[model samples]
Target: MNAEPRPQESLSGKEISPTDPARFPRLGFLLGLVVVYWALYFVVGAIDKPYFYGFIYGLASALLFAICFFTWWWGNRAIRRSEKILGFVLIVGVGVLVGKFSDRTVNFFPLCTLGLPLVATLVLGWLALVKRSLISSHWLGFAAAVALGFGVFDLIRMDGFDSSLKTHLSWRWTPTAEQRFLAENAASAAAVKPSVAKTVPLHADASTWTAFRGPNRDGVAHGTNVPTDWNSNPPQQLWKRAVGPAWSSVIVIGDRVYTQEQRGPVESVVCYDAATGQQVWAHDDETRFDEAVSGAGPRATPTFAEGRIYAFGGTGILNCLDAETGKVVWSRDTKNDSQGKPPMWGLASSPLVTDKNVIVYGGGEANKSLLAYHQDTGNLAWTAPAGQQSYSSPEIVTIAGVRQCLMFHDFGLTSVDPATGRKLWESGAVMKGAPRTGQPHLVDGNKLAVAVLDGPGVSLVSVTKEGDQWKVAPVWASKDLKPEFPDFVVHDGSAYGFDSSIFCCLNLATGKRSWKDGRFGRGQVILLADQGLLLVVSESGEAILQAADAQARKELGRFQALNGKTWNSPVVANGRLYLRNAEEMACYDLTPRRQASIR
Candidate 1:
């Protein structure tokens, strides 16, 4: 009939055939579906609801796997069923093994969650191409191509990608500059002479930051003339020093700067000269707390009051130390008193010093959820029942003429009398089991602006007293601005802070967004009320100064303040700007006159 079939013209060549023309259109449709599904998945995942984010991403990844498997089946029909099944099993099994044990810097969970299916598709395509010699294996190749393409696309779209992505991409990579600085500083800290307490005088009245988030636990910087224009005259870098891993902000009292950090395996409460950045004195305890995302070190900023520093460690250790000497006056293990384990993030609540007691969130579901210890001696003053734990620090605010400490617990917000630890008013329905990390901003005398990691963005709550009972109810809830960790400040009848790392402002009365702009990552902000400016320390390590106008965002000036992740809040004491993270600490002179002594 036809010429005798050549050895080269075998059944494999004719039967296998090129990727069918009819199948090409279907393949294109499936590829488009994969792209569209993931695009919407990413958009939904970034909406700030943790549970919804988990669900959408999980569903999207699963669907992607199914679609890829379908392509494999359509393309590898020539391969034996056993061979195809065996290849799939072998590829997925090896992928799971390697993905689980791989260096986590690249994000271990995501690699496995997104990589296993990709490897399966790739290996299946390889088998069809090289082993079975199926011409239609090109369809499987398309599936593998889609997997590889989206894996990178997803990584780039992650939150905090610009600043934190490098930390994830590199394998066992180290910041050589930061490491050298820490090493040198550690050597210097060790060789430093004894503290000359009598030589340096302490000015108690000169304290600028006596507690966390400034005086009143509000993110307001008073009497500060923050430079509006940094173009011609930039802020001076007065002092730069290396610090250990910690998210604790520096509290400046008198001539010393107090903060807690992890010094290797020890949790250290340190004091440095505010003006010179010299290590004054440091006290170390044999304790350490570690986490993957938050990293190692203390979370709560040290509280300075009554010539003593009340320091709380991430491991639940509370110490009352001498402000000048860094010597432990008294210490208490809060976890023991509460009979509860440390929180997932750690005991991040800073010690709240009142006129009579030092209040801290113990998070113990028993009667010891909120514990108040005597300020001077670490003796138990009072213990009260709070629902569960909260990472937010306790704050003393006067609501409806009643001075109570507000504790945003895991269950909801609870206000208790500081002296007796008596629950004055509790708002359990304000937020559910979602984490309440943001501080409740007092909108006025009776209303509070509260935000959480889940639910509606922010809610305005009104506290009013009808006879002996105090009732707290939501006035309005808006899905405009949701804060993750950084606190927002209310100014000119509006609240300003990061709405999932995007700087935004919301009208307090209506709970509606006035305007949302700027992408500052999940960094902290300080309200320069005196100057009508918003000083934002971006998570990308830049200090940006913007106007507090609700009409529109106007970025006046910006400067690179740090080189790494900066979640630590910026402190403006007198005219100096102090900023630090887990790795380093820096001080900048914000006022026109440079080198003003931080005395």
Candidate 2:
């Protein structure tokens, strides 16, 4: 003690004590690293694909930064080492546990989202409270911080955030809101007025939109009659109804609209009266596939062809149901018969119905991934090899004037003869981590446009046959317009889609971006080729109608369609526009006379 007192005045009049420590140096370094790390990560979103995992990682870094700051701020004080270590361990361990248990329907990840801010509140509060004892103040600060954090999260997500978390923790507890509201009100709507049962107007005698994208599995709604303006004469709200959580799009056939949803533990194949928004029928299966990011329910749209609905659940159950009443005609579980397991995100491929068979892709590599069942019977028609399945639905397109089934799997693009299941051609393009969820867009006769999450870019390929041998060669690749789940449509030699979160257009011939604007999250688009209108259903639930022009982007009109992150594709049948998300669904009458009647 005497020696220390002598050194206190010797070192340039600076205090020399074992307990005293400088805070700025260590604190500054840690802050600098946190700033730089976040800056780089922000850049990653702009250049590469913007993902949900990236947001999670950013939150983790924020929590780590808060911990480091707290450690340094209290280093010079009389702090307990055991308490500090225990606090950090609890923060990390609790976050990991929360993530591990969270699911699409029942979400607890909000706790982890608010974790760092809560930690900051505790640390700052402890530092400010000078009268109390260090140990008591620190513990008190933590309790207060947690309470404040919960309050803040609840305030931000006032629309059923607590209920969602409760449902996740306890499966028996049903989260109530619009989903229940719509279910209860649907009966009233049906009782008030019966559905007219009108036939969907046809253009060029094309098939009804009974599949994922449209009749051809392309995003084009041929010969549609949509109004060009929504300023003075807005769209007439035919009906707005509540729907369960699911990314499946609405497919219209005759007077019914078919989709898939999660009703508690059962995955339901639901059909509603298109005119009245009434629940016509629903067939339930004791299967549920949950993902925290994508939300719960089946991801595949129910396919309707020839008075039958081919419904595929997220858990790999393929059921062929009767169109009139939702009764199971035939059922098969790909997970049971096929050797492959469900992908991390679950089975998302929509069933493709051909003239004689219903085709779907799932597990197994050796001719088992792509399973084709006979249309009339449930017997296996054929099987083809798809390296590792992607979430993308199999599409039937006539490439090189030959009818073949095209599938973009984890490996790359694969084309197989639909009748024989023979591999006609395979592309060298590879996808890593996230699967290809976007369906391939048919450019022209034999050309194709493929967009995956993190591929090299939006790739253009032409399938040609030379002397009975099929070949797939790339025409161009553009990194400027990379789509994750948002599918692009090629109209008049131009491809349009959401480039990450921003909507972009690219020249199909040159593979050069024309312009990118309108940040619409990961939304979906449908082109009314006859009207030259592109109906864009934004992820945040806005309907934007833009001119399908290659020269420049022209947004003509816009309206609020729904209220959530909408990944489901919009459907336009007759003069009615149908839109939905995980929460609700709406029908807007795009008929000119109906639109004029709106006040």
Candidate 3:
């Protein structure tokens, strides 16, 4: 037993006694940490605040590198100090190089940060611990395993994300939805004679959606009483058609619908036939604005006023065009008019047309914050100070018997005269420097409810006028009912909106949550006030029907309406439901006469 031992030979028939010591001391510990890390990841994604999501993700990433180095250290039982240092440089160096230089989307950033590295560790363990004699050097085997891991990741690309922050990934070389649509449109056009786009006749319908949310810019669908009994009377799809990338919602005016989208190098204000889903007229500009998460498109929903279309582009270009001809009557670059740079998302003011002026958010330096232009002439009417930027549009609301134009931005709630850009009142302390998105909801008669971005949730405040000064003060704030990009509506003394991506109801008077259920993603909703029902559009393009009750969440029925991510709000007029996302537009009959048919 005391005799000098000879060199050990591995299964590869090479001397490996010095390097391969037949030990994986770090293996058991590595497996245990993985379980703990995943448990924390899911919990953080579910209940944690929006800002703290990165902290846990970053801490776990550091542990992955620790696993790599420790596996190399403990796998070698008899290596010298120089060999140990050299192994460190090799394993850690290549990892830093690959992780930093790889092309990827933020869609899968949090998930793949730990997932791919763990896969590599599994491969290393299989060869080093399970099949211990196969490798001559632990360092070489570890390098091979890491390379295979990156190779697998390199072939995968992220498309986008759902509301729950999960990635939608696909093979790298796969054709995108936009590419397929473009190809199909080109092929169809080539089959016929290339002719100029014709002007379509326009008329105001009996029941119309002439603005972003409605005539009042509130998410209330009037006149149509949608039957909630889907088994007995289900919604039927009338038509569906492919559309370009855009966050813009459709504004229905009688037989034609108006919206904006980005097609390749052009940003188009298009009019489509509501009955047939066919292109009636399209006006294109030589400009395109695109972002990774929101994709490429115009951001603001076009408004129809005085038989003219008022459309604001994502890149700050605002155009007023003839309703029937799609001809630009007047155009102005709002970025230049306001003297302010575009925000990270871009200019998203849905032009507010008044009796004398058309108001839009300027967000510029100095005192040029809000800009109003003459309706007929493109002359600048007035400019006033506002928040630096906002994705919310200008809304006209009457508070305390006075008509005021309301704008929600980083500076919280602001009110100005629609004809002249004069700041009337503002509540800025609660919402400073946070990206304001949720539309300011007028609660009761004098109170207002809004989404506070970093303030974490919903805030209700009372607005009253004492003499010449206007007073706005907070009533109650609830972290349980936060809604950012999606707006909320007040119904039967309660507010109905998304708490994060899940549907929730909160008491307007107390700011206390009543009930929250159904994970509908970060989609949109419309209150069918005529029938006391809520029509919800899920992010995955499903139409859900539920009663507007504060006691409990009662889901009446649901059906798939579109495909892919749907963040755009739904429009209901008469007995028809009109909805769309960046990729497509659709119409459905929600009346009892249509006994559930989908195209």
Candidate 4:
């Protein structure tokens, strides 16, 4: 009865009839707008020349927008039977494009292109099932598109695709097989050599620092009565010459002084005139290697033996050179065939020549442990089961009436039958350091003292024979005496070596610090007992001559010889001292006759 029988209101707000084309058109237009906007967004993103991640992001945006549009369009077309299939095809086509784009950028981790599309598909599929409307079919279409996109991306990211892409992009960076072979051969060639006759020694009595620790490997000079006190100036510089970079010490057989140096790509075994420090001859071969901790060149001291010079490079290249000429006799690349990867500080262990066999720590398996190669032919003779490879050179010592080769390995100290590579006995002396670099010196032919740098202090092991078996026991252990470069020398019942910075002396019998003072500044030391002095070379190339006493540290002389660091152990022979830095070599005669002496 009131206002014109007011308009009748229905519960269902506006009846959306399936037969109404206008309502469906409006929905289709809305869906199309969303699709167009998404496509535009993707196109704009792709224009920025994006990398993998950016490309994936762009594809995702485009796919999302297309999904929304298709879903709305599906709602519009589902009402008309003829337009439904067409709407589904369009949605599927849009999905396929999204999937293809997603595949192009899957290399980006976590934010995977395929992952998002697959997730969107699953989510849309759920939403579609929840709503049984035409919009639901649209979501299903979107899901299908995402799945297709994911599959495309997966296929494109496969190994085969990568291979093809690499082939297409191959350039000079891709090394040819021939180039690789040549490089490999060059590395292997370090082990081969030409033969040269050894020059007769100028004088047999003119001693040289033959091996690492000189004649006895005990850091003791035999029969050379060097005066303890000089008049005013100790000695003179006979001569001085510049050598290449190396940490190797000098080995003077007679008139010639041999050592290893790095020129450029080759590590050369250089021989100099002992009297004048003149460059005599150098055997250069290309065996270049880059190291971070240790300097480039040779680390092992050249062993002058049987008319041949044996040298080990920083890269584990062992070369036998002619004593006179710079000709190579035979070489062996321990890096290629042996399990011996060069130590972190480089191969510092000099080759030990015993009888006719040249012994070295090859770091091979148990069968090829401490290798004994024929000195003449470079042929493998025998190998002992050395537990671990050591940077310390093997010392031939007669322990307890039996001649044995004493060597240090990663596990501990070991003695091997020098004749047959047989293990005589091994003391379970665990070094706190992972790698043992310094050679253990024998004290009075009865006790052995070894120093480790990184961890664990020095230990003196006494070797004794118990019936048929040899026994070694820790006499004393001291954490105070840590040597980073070389082992301490034990003379007159005392151990003298560098401990981090301070030069220390300890009693061999008791690991007690007798005296620890006079910081040598983080360097390695070589004890010259005959001269009654300790030759300490600091990391800063300062050569110090001090008294071999633990009670009172007395500095006799000091001089800075080189510009670079001096990690090389100095060699003193025939009253002349040889020192080397990374780029220069110097010789100082500590005799009363020379002009420039230790002043």
Candidate 5:
């Protein structure tokens, strides 16, 4: 015991130096470092396209690279044991915190933030192996941390990521010039009249349902009497035929019931017999776009004017067809003229036809905002500065005795001179969202009623004139009357429209709710002023006829027509009611004489 005590005292005076390993597996550690670095880079690269994801991924990469390099460089230093432990813990904690924040901030595909923890664990493991004597239990801890971090990230990603990723990835490439040209012509053809050889009128009262509204571009129909009520049991199913997959409403003119449908590889322009609902003629063009919402079909209501039926397809193909026969006369490419891509839901806005020019919202940037084409030929008439494409159709209405084409884009309400496409009055009516699908309604003749779903409720603007200058001011606004699909119709000083899940009636003057209660289901509606009724075709194929009033919301009658969802707004013309679902079209005679006994 005495000899050992003397030896311990001598050892205390001498310096204790831990022997450095002859070979510390430097190549293996470097190889692992390179592997981890490239893996992290690959992950970051995957999410660096969309600007929001790019910033987050960049931050993650910076943190990961810092951790990796610092750990590798200073890991073997003979620092104090407690200090070393604290530094290692701090590095890992910082890495994990950065990764978690990145994951939360950039909520998009593939999860680039997950690579942060993976890189940290790899670096820490490499450092621990290189400097084994300095730290203990680090390898086990790193393994656990990496496994937990990856598991948590994957779980969050699964829940947060929208299913639109698959669709977006498929259409990443920019369309070719030919494709773009085709889209533009398709859009032009959708709104412009085709110069065709004169033929006898199929019906005495052939009128074009040009835009989403009608010939007047308003839901109000004059010159014809439409039945207000119908029989109880299925009424009279005049004609029911299989149509392609489309939600576009049927526009009746003469003997032709013009509409659009999507079959396999083509979004076909189908013309049917107005009386019997029989197929008259059809024109099919290959629209290879495979989309999700509205499916792969034409979304625009064919505008029939001056012997031409103008149709806009899902992929932005505007075609001018002969009203009598489905023949392409002349076409213009809207996609080219506007230098814009199709909206995610496709070019859904129905074409607008003025006296001699066909007006349309291009939804592009620069030289192609709102465009006007010659009705006879597909010649470009005039172009407005490109703004935002809206699913809403353009309207030509007179505000303060001045004829102006009113267009609601993603930015706001724009009034352009229809004759020249010149901007008359631009109001700061920017919607919260980038796209608007509902048509604008003119309330009380002086006020403009516009509805945007999931954004602002409804904005009622007063259109006044100060000499040559026009002024638009917000009179009232309400979030309750958000029109999802069908445009609101103002009648008797009140606005009547369906707001997503419910139908609401609001005072157009004050945006005040008078009465709102109806389980009309999620479907588009068109108001029949003559009948004083709202024809709502629900998503589940049920059509409900309700009184267009705030005080007494009476359901006149309800009937089921198509097998699929009824997205098309019901059309009442020539004592006949036209309704369509995704795959089937039906016509019902609602003449007062036929259903007089039932009522």
Candidate 6:
């Protein structure tokens, strides 16, 4: 006996059968999931703490996959039977083939959501609905996907990731920021300038900024009064020029500014004129440190002390250069000297130049994490324990009437004697597997504030010194202000910095948030202590001035400082403001002239 005719419907001028056998049977369901998948991506940026952006985006992408896999199993109650087993085999085989042959950087989440779901619905769904062919559609799809795996992705490349963990992709043939800068500068290059480092005096009062995060490494500019009224007394651009790719902040002394950059394969310590923004000298090391996560170049800033420029390269080389001319005084292989493995993002510890020794954190190993070499002789002075990893630089501060060197590592905060490399005190780590960044902020001389990513945020560790021993413990741990990589500064009994991507103020006394306002990405804040003002340089290179009050936030003025993703810290010295990122550097005249200039 003949079976009753199957129900037929017309879609797009083609006759369709509802129960027709098909390679991708649940096209309607997949269409719905794709809609939901796209919606999830649109909202992931709205999540708090950009470092936690993966939590939402991963969950949303996994939800559709989990449901797809579950339904695939549940609907096929007899999938093991001989008659129904072919579809199962085909599904598993196609997945394995595509995964194994696709480009290494091609993520599965995007593949499943964007490529497979949508295309399968169009091709297999149409064939199943029209010709009622399951095996043919399956074979055709397998062939098409295999072709895509070997052909389409070879032309693409991953540039890097933003703070939100979103992948930045580009064409493989496109020129990078460093390459474009090199080509442009070489075309119109002028004659090489002589060394001006000798003409400028390196010695200055406490006002000169010769270290990362300013003179004290506290991210505070003391005594200078920055003009807050940008409308009335706007900043004038002294000079704007392109620089090599680097995350290093600039250090200013006299009329000279020094920083690090990656030029081609060489990591250079470049000295530029603070007045003309001219290149005076550059000490190049024949090495390169390039990674996809944070792009490339040096992460630590150059330190200036006692007529010497101390710079730590990204690949773990330390060099002491003469401040008079760019001559190498002494060089040490820090990675080889300490015998420790480098971190994922490279050794970013900005060298701390003390009276006798230059101290830096170590790689993973017992009693080898903190290495202090002689300042002039380049001899290994001493080594201390500092856990496995840290991007934080060693800081010199006086706590409880005792001067000690402070360093932040994966585990926690460690205070050591600068002269002896003795471990004075240690605190426990907050976020496991998350290496600490940003130097420790010492509040009230002893209270230390340290922050971590994807963890319980910043913790206030109380450091005190007793008769013969030292003690360190957390006074209050909180998520009130998670600065990620940017350093926070304490002023007027209150701490101010970025809470992930937003600007926030925290009361250092109570750990309570005074007020949280503004989205500044991952930028640094320089507290102009004399003017009671805060100069904020955002990740996208906008400089904003706001009232440094704990009660309420008020924006005084803002101006475009640079034109790229800015992660490096800014420097202000001798009536000038200097800012740089991976792309370019600029000198602005904040010299109380009250004139606006843009070039």
Candidates in order, TM-scores: namely 0.82, 0.82, 0.86, 0.64, 0.66, 0.86
Question: How many residue pairs clash per model?
Answer: 0, 1, 0, 8, 18, 2
RMSD of each: 5.4, 5.9, 4.3, 17.8, 12.6, 4.5
Better of 2 and 3 by TM-score: 3
Question: Which scores better on lDDT, 2 or 6?
Answer: 6
Tell me the tens digit of each residue's lDDT in model 4 across 1-599.
65543222111123344344423233335534544654664565434221223435555765665576556645653245445565456445545554455433233331232344344444344433444443324434544554554444444432111100111112323542224434544564466544433354633354667887686676766656555554356545566555666667878777678888776677788877766665567787788654533435677787877678888777777788778776888998765546657655566678888878888876644345577878998877787766556677888888778888987877777788887888888875554325676777777778777775224678777899989878777777788676654457776778888765567888777788898886555567777666667777776787777888767888877777565556677777777777776656777777765455322
Residue 507, model 5: Cα distance from true site in angstroms? 1.5
Candidate 1 stretches with Cα past 4 Å from truth are 1-85, 92-101, 104-108, 124-167, 173-182, 190-207, 428-432, 595-599
Tens-digit lDDT string for candidate 6 (284-315): 99998887667889999999988899999888
Model 1 clash pairs are: none
lDDT of 5 by residue, 10-90 (tens): 111222333522222243554576577668667745441332244456566656665765575456443434445654665
Model 3, poorest ten-residue lDDT window? 48-57
lDDT of 3 by residue, 1-599 (tens): 68765666432334645446632333454555555655665776676344224444555565664565466564655444555566557555655566565545422443245545565465546544634554555555656666665555566666665555556777877876777777876686567544344343454554888888887778998787667788777788888988888889999887788899888888999988776677768888899886554577888899988789999888888899998779989999888878887776667788888857888886866568788999999888998777778888888888878899988878667898787767889885544445678688888788888788337788888899998799988888888798868888889999999887788999987889999998887779889888889988998999999999999999998899999999998998768889899788999987857464555
Clashing pairs in 4: 99-149, 103-153, 191-331, 235-596, 235-597, 236-594, 236-595, 236-596
Per-residue C-alpha lDDT of model 2 across residues 1-599, encoded as one tens digit per residue: 35443222111123345444321122244445445654754565455345544555656765665566566544623334454566556555655554454433324544644445555555445444532332333354554554454434332322322101211222323544435755665566557665445465311235367788887878888757766768866688888878877889988876778899887778899888877777877899998887655557788898877778899899899999888867889998877656777787788889998859888988555558888889888788888877676888889888767898988887777888888788888885555444667888777788888875226568888878998998877888779787776788888889888887788889998989999888777788999998778999887799999998887789998999898667889998867899988788888888766433321
Candidate 6 collision pairs: 362-369, 411-429
**Tens-place lDDT digits, model 1, residues 30-139:** 44544554575567545544333454566566667666655655464444454445545545554455545544433544554455554544443443344344453343
Against the reference, the lDDT scores of all candidates come to 0.73, 0.71, 0.76, 0.63, 0.64, 0.75
Residue 37 of model 6: what lDDT?
Answer: 56
Q: Candidate 6, 475: how far from true, in Å?
A: 2.7
Cα lDDT for residue 128, model 3?
A: 48
